[model samples]
Target chain A: MKSAAMSEAAPATTSLPYTDTKPAGHADFYFAINATFRFILRHRGEEALRSCWRDIGGSYYRPVSKQWTEQGMHGVAEYWRAFFKAEPGAEVEVVESADEVRLEVARCPAIHHLRTHGREIVPQFCQHCYFVNEAIASPAGLTARVCGGNGTCTQRFIKRTVEAEAQNLEDIATAS
Target chain B: MIGCYDFCGHYEWTFEWLRQQGGHELVRAYWDEAIHQDSQLHASQLIGEKGIEGMKEYWGPTLADEGAVYERTVTEDVFRIDMHECPSKGFLLRNGLHQYADYCDHCMGWIGPLMQKAGFVIDHEHNHCGQCWWEMRRIDDASPASAPGTLAGTSDVRLRPGWKSPATDHYERATDPDDKT
Candidate 1:
C-alpha cells in the first residue's frame, strides 16, 4: 500500500526488478524506469565525466564553485593515467582477468531525476546506472536483491578497467 | 563469458547489516513526504540575501561524528561513503551536497543539513539501469540497416532528455569571393 513518486504512475503489470509489490496504476512507469536504467547503463563513465564538463562549459562554475565539477575532477584525465599504471607512467594493462575489475574514479558528475505529474509517471534518471555485473561485488549483487526504501537504488559510481578505442581521453591527454 | 559474468557480478554485504541492526538511525521508507514538503520550502520563503537563519535551521554538523566510511569525490563533490550497499554505478556514495541546487548557490539548501544529519549518504540512483555492454561486429550478417552504420544500443535511459548539452550556435556568415566587406 506504499506509494512512491513513481508508484502512482507505474502500471500493475510491470514488476520492479527491486520489489515484489506491483505498482498502483501508472502506465508510463515501465517505460520511464527502464529508459533511465538503460541510459545509465550505456553511458556510465561517459555521462559521469560529462557532468563535470557541462559545468565547466557553462558559466555555472568558477574558481570557488562548490559544484561537482569544482570538488571533483581535480587531476582530470591525468589522474587515471597514474591510477591505471602499474607504477606510474608504465605500459597500459589489459583487463584480461575478471578479478581485476578495478578502475579509479576521477571527476564524477551524476544527476538524474524521477518525476511524475497527475497521470504521467516518470522513470528514474541519473548520470549512470551500474549493471548486474556491479552488483556481483556487493551482497545485493550476490543475491540480486534490492535494499533500502522499496528497493530503489541511490546514484553512485565505481571505476573499472576497459580497453580504449583508437581515440580516448587518456590517449588524447597523453598525446602531448 | 564466465569471465565477463564474474567481471559484471554485483554483490553487497554491508548496508543490510546496518539496516538490520537496531540503533539510533533515520531511514526513510518513502521520500515523497520530503519531496512534497520541500516544494514549499522555496528560495523566496526566507528573508535576506543569503538567508543564514534559514540555513542554520536547515543544516547542522554532518554525521562525521559517527563511525563510517567517507570520501570527498573530486568530480562529484560527493564526500560520503556507503557503509555496505554497493550496488554499482547507480549505487553511489554521496552526501549528495549537490542535490540542493535550486536555492543555494553553494548547496546552502536544506538538503545540506539533511545530508549532515544522515551521516552517510546513498543516492536513490536516478540512473535506471547499467550501461550497454553490446559490441557490433556485423550488421544482420549483411546489408540494408547496416550500410549507413549501426545504432549503439544503450542501457536504461529514463531521465535523459536534457541530459546532453547542445552545442552553441554562433556560426559565422559564409564568405563570398566577389563580395566586399
Candidate 2:
C-alpha cells in the first residue's frame, strides 16, 4: 500500500477536472468551508444542508462523474490521487485494486488546518465526505462508504450493487 | 471531500444553491455571516483594529499565497489594490464553472460589511474579467476615488484596453454589496 504524503512531496501533474496555476490550495480556505457548512446547517437545518452537499456532488462535480463513468475504477483512483495532491497538508494514500479504490487519509487536511488555526469546526464537518462523495459515486455506477474521521478516515469507492452495504452515518465522527 | 483547491468552484456553486433554497437574501446573509464574520475573522479583526495598515497586512500575504497577480498602493488616507488576474475568478474561468450569475459580487458581499465595521468605505469596480480595483478610505474622508492612473500609477487596472465590460459593476463609498451601480 503506497501512500503519498503530500506535504513532503512535489505535486505531480493530476487529472483533476479543474486546474489552477497554483500547485496546491491555500489551507486557510478550510476556514470558509467550515463556515459555509455551519451557516447552511444553522439557517436551513441538517436535512437542507445535506441536500446542498448532495447537489454539490451531483451537479458541481458532474464532470468528474462523467470521467468515472467513462473510465471506471481507474478514473476514481486518478481523481483522488490528484485531488489530495492539490490540498495543502493532506496526508493520504489512494490504494486501487480491481474492485475498488480506498483512500487512507492519515491526516485529514481540513480538520488539521482548522484546529491549527483555532477555528471552531462545525460538528458535522466530517460527514461532508460521505454525503458529497456518495453523490458523486452513485451516478457512475459506484458507491462510497466512509468510516473514522476528525483527522483520520477511510473512504472506499466501490461498484454499486444490491449486495453493497449502505453507509452508516454513525461511522463518521463529529468534529469538535 | 470539498477540497480547497477547487474551493472557488464549489463556493460559486454554493451561491446558487443557497439562492435556490431561500432566494437572494439568503445568499446575501451567507456572505455577511458565513464569509465576513466567520471565515474572514482575521481580516475583520486586523482591519478593525489597525485600519489602513491592517488592510495592507491582511491582503499582502493573502493574495500572494493565493497566487494573485496584482499591485497595491497604500497612502495615509487610502489603501488601493489593482487586481490584474484574480486567482479565484481565474480558477473558475479556467475550469468553465459558472453557477452564480455574478460570481465577482461575493467579494463585496463580505468585504463591504467588514469595511463598514472598520470605519472605512470602499470605492471599487470590477470588469468581471479578472480585472478590478479597490480603494478603501476612512468613512469621513470626503476625497472621491482617484482617477484611474493617479493612485496606482501605471499599475491601475482600469488603464488596460480590455478592462471595460458592459457588465462592469461599480461602487462608490459603498458599505454593502447591494451598493454597486
Of candidate 2 chain A, the 10-residue stretch with the lowest lDDT total is A1-10
| Per-residue accuracy of model 2 over B1-181 as CA lDDT, tens digit each | 9999989999999999999989989999999999999999999999999999999899988988887889999999999999998889988887788989999999999999999999999999998889899999999998999998988888999999879998999999998888877
Report each candidate's C-alpha RMSD, comma-separated, in the order given.
Answer: 27.1, 4.6
Q: Which candidate is the best by TM-score?
A: 2
**Superposition error at A43 for model 1 (Å):** 26
How many steric overlaps are in each model, in order? 70, 0
State the lDDT of candidate 1 residue by residue for B1-181, as single tens digits.
Answer: 0010111111111112112332112112101112212321332233122333433322221212111121211111222121111122222222111221111111112233333233312121111122111111111122121111122112112123432223211101101111111
Candidate 1 stretches greater than 4 Å from native: A1-125, A131-133, A136-176, B1-23, B28-181
| Model 1, global lDDT | 0.21
Give the residue spans of candidate 2 off by over 4 A.
A1-13
Worst 10 residues of 1 chain A by lDDT: A167-176
lDDT top scorer: 2
